[model samples]
Target: MDWVFLSELAINGALTGLLYSLFAIGLVLIYKASSVPNLAQGGLTMVGAYVVLALSHDAGLPLWLAIPLAAVIMFGLGFGIERVALRRLAGRPVIMILMLTLGLDIFLRGTTLAIWGGTSRSIELGVSYEPLFLGDLFISRIHLVGAGVAVALFVAFMLFFRTRTGIKLRAIADDYMASWSVGISVEHGVGLSWALASVVAVATGVIWGEIQGVDQALSLLLLKGLTVAVLGGLDSILGAIVAGIILGVIENVGAEFLDPLVGGGSRELIVAAVLILTVMIRPHGLFGRHDIERV
Candidate 1:
């Protein structure tokens, strides 16, 4: 009933959701293009963040330069991952693809652990840790910056999908065989999707590291993004966007109002319940299109 408190929670949660959308959008891109559930998304994100850390910290590069460097590295990583491990497995059973991605996730995580150690390290983006206040409502500067970057990138993506390259991407997403049949170069399109997805993952990783620092736990964001993807719809970018915002708001509200009553941890409990509820009520998700395959 307290308007100020409610408004604060809503805005902060929505900001968090905006960050979540970065990775979820990447997941949808992969699924749309390759029909593969990329379990390695979190691993890619973690690797991207570490690249940033290494460049900015160890190499003494500026944050600005390091971020783009991370993007480049992630793109190469994604493309090569597909080329070496995924390209040959195209059209394989879904379970096989899923297991491969799971293995990739493990491989990437192990590599990160070997390089970064187990300790959590600050991202040191050289940005002010100041909070922006609107009367009684306040938010962190990092969150605002991240939300702004996310919105700009999201708008750019909207435009990207309208270009010729995007058309090819969409064609591949809609139908792999049909795309190849039309000489669209399915392998090229899928490889591009992986590259682009990793770029997005890098952005998400940098923003997330700024907010939560860099650590092994960052890989767990894949689960959070996956939850957003599932709640929104595996193949729907808009669904991921909407679902991320909804889940973020619900999490903050539940934590504030229900945590005390439950003695603690009600926020996660509520989110897990929402996932189950969404599965029960709308198996295809709120905006997921139902596919009718007559087999």
Candidate 2:
């Protein structure tokens, strides 16, 4: 058992987990505000990445300029989805909303393919992908920076939600009918949640785009992000962070040890296993509140 090798895996896994947390936060915000798990998050993320790619690579805009511009575009897209497609179905069954999000996902994927032509392209962030050596252990620079940025954004959002507008959104999440009865604008809260989710999607897309090329395959991140969200709690932002770290570490360590026995590719399987176990053991997740209603 080489301690250095083990340490490297754990550290890298933690950093990667932060990235996973970023992916889950958008889903959390949407679910918290609207009780929708946002099945189209992956599509939103993939499309956001392509938008950035188009802006930077195709339009010759600088990467810094392109990222914020893409975020604005995605924000509008998310708000549009909520206002146009989701608003009318506000009081419908949860299953209906899920189906609609799935439809939106398919639509987004098709639109991206038609526009981007299914080509895998990279976004040059100008960040070194070189591994940083710390004694006998090594860490990826990209992962480190990505994780830092994620944490900062998460903290900012947490603070933002503490404001009056944020309180209105939280109130709506707590009791939609009650909030509406009290004159809180549920539509605006849900729309803002979707818009913020889209903005978050852009960040997730850019980081993941740098890690993996920007393409339709980027949508597959939905599974990984979903696993993290389920484990953390659909409505728990803090839980997302905690669950992401645990998932990252466990997946990395498990893959390192179990891959040898299973031939390989166990990392992907770990997510499914964790999600199943979480559902079986703690359906509301570690930090999620248990909803109780007396009929």
lDDT of 2 by residue, 149-252 (tens): 77887897789889998888888878889998999988888999999999999999999999998999999889989999999988888888889899999999
At residue 46, give the lDDT of candidate 2.
94
RMSD of each: 1.7, 1.2
Show where candidate 1 strays beyond 4 Å: 292-295
Clashes of each: 0, 0
Off by over 4 Å in 2: 293-295
lDDT of 1 by residue, 169-218 (tens): 88887787888788998887888889999998889889899889898888
Where is model 2 poorest over a 10-residue stretch in terms of lDDT?
149-158
